[model samples]
Target: APFAAPRGMVATWVGHATVLVQAAGLNILTDPIWSDYASPLPPFGPKRAAQPGIKFDDLPKIDLILLSHNHYDHMDLPTLKRLWERDRPKIVTSLGNDTILKAHGIPATALDWGQSVSGAALNGLAPQAVIQCGSYEHCPDYQVHVTRNHHWGSRWGADRNRALWSSFVIETRAGNIFFAGDTGAGDMGWPMQARRYGPIRLALIPIGAFRFWKGQMRSDAHIGPLQAVDVFQRLGASTAIPIHWGTFRLSYEQWDTPPRMLELALRCAGIARKHFAPLRIGQSLPVPTVSAVPIGPKRCDDRAIRALE
Candidate 1:
């Protein structure tokens, strides 16, 4: 896009579900995980195949941090603490995760579904570019709402469902965005969420780490390309960007399968290939965004159309 990025809003894809969103002149991060490994250890478990796109020092000034859940891949304590110590961005997340961040000196605020913080214009700061929480989760003033996904939520304990797992319905001057942290094909809650927060301007949905355990491990956790397309249609969103792929081989599919399949499925659905994107790691796309060309019916002019079948 040739337009200058106005101070009102902007969103950048860091890697995985981690995104850098600028709204109302505020730089915000969503489900930021910068650690080398998505595990409790340093040398074992799923290690990141690609290096982080946003270096710690090079990150723009951050004013807010939105954590979607407690999964290690979604929430990294070390990364959170670093951001907290440097910028002290206000942390907004589901219930109980406040405790998790607080343990790391993050001083997070918790919110439940249907609850939210009041809207405000850019002030540059509470005195210094900081937004304060309106009230507690159970309070009537909170403005954030929680939505469900066909995914599980747990962190460092056996208490699954103990902490509320959800996605965010963010209303900015730019537009409304639905951030689906991590979810599976069944997506137990998006339909209801779409009914509530439907017509989202942009949807940041998960698209990888799904295989083998499609019915057991992450059985209800991750979605493949077709299911991802369903998510895009379910929300009635303007644009859908696929994440959670190619960064780590957490699933049984080939490393290159996601983008290829996503393109194929988008075609099969008669949706334009550009509408459903699998962006390169660390790259950003201007949202409320669309395809470059007007997509047409499958022309038998090339092998591209044949691959869709």
Candidate 2:
């Protein structure tokens, strides 16, 4: 049976950066890609070790799509076309990305960093229609804020940075939701930008692909477990589920290194492991509305850091 919509918030990790977020009477997807190989050429490039958590056919009527960038791994054209043809969901992406989609006959709204679009525009209905709809909370309107993140974008070799990459903050009556779309710990201040939107009830953070050299815990292009914990604390997120790991091999770390290191990092920071957890693919869970309780900053001991090696 197709999944029914939820009145509150429920999230399902499909794999990689794909997550199905059901909240505020909407079904949202983040950087969705269901291709077996994360590449432009079929049967080439990095192949997925596991299938998508929720089959593409089983996805509910998608109300919105949060496309982070134009990378092949993040932006699979076939999947996007199928989705656009089927549901005609409101697709939101950063600057220059809309052109890429337009060429493929998929319409998307482009926004720069710090810009936002209200739910009225997302519904594809006239403002007057939305006002008269008389649904819950005035048709359960929400806002999508395009926030800045440190990441590059390119489909081929020479067109790097032509499109801006971004993260998003979805504001709703229930609570705000932050999707940290494919970011690195650049100056470590982006999380606070998302925090300013309001209390974040749920956060989707990345904790993988940070290792390239052996024993390298962090990367200029990605955040490992240690930096992820810092991001979670700085953002003051109520609860987070780790993504971008255990689905595809993008880095040199062990298969379980990201989650294991995350557990260790959480312990070192004196936070409960459940606060930032890893979920099995295809798992769905409700997110409780939480007050804004910011975890104060703390440095993990050196011995704990040494154990990560």
Q: Clash pairs of candidate 2?
A: none
Model 2 stretches astray by more than 4 angstroms? 1-7, 126-129, 136-140, 292-303
Give per-residue CA lDDT, model 2, range 1-309, as digits (tens).
124344478889998889998886778899889889998887988899889999999998888899999988788899999999999888999999999999999999999999999888766566777668766435647789999888889999899899999999998766788988888889888999989998888999999999999768888778888888898888898889899998888899988889989988987787877778898988886886776544445446787678776
TM-score for all models, in order of appearance: 0.81, 0.93
Residues 160-184, model 1: lDDT tens digits:
8777777777765455677887777
Cα deviation of 38 in candidate 2 (Å)? 0.3
Best by TM-score: 2
Clash number for model 1? 13
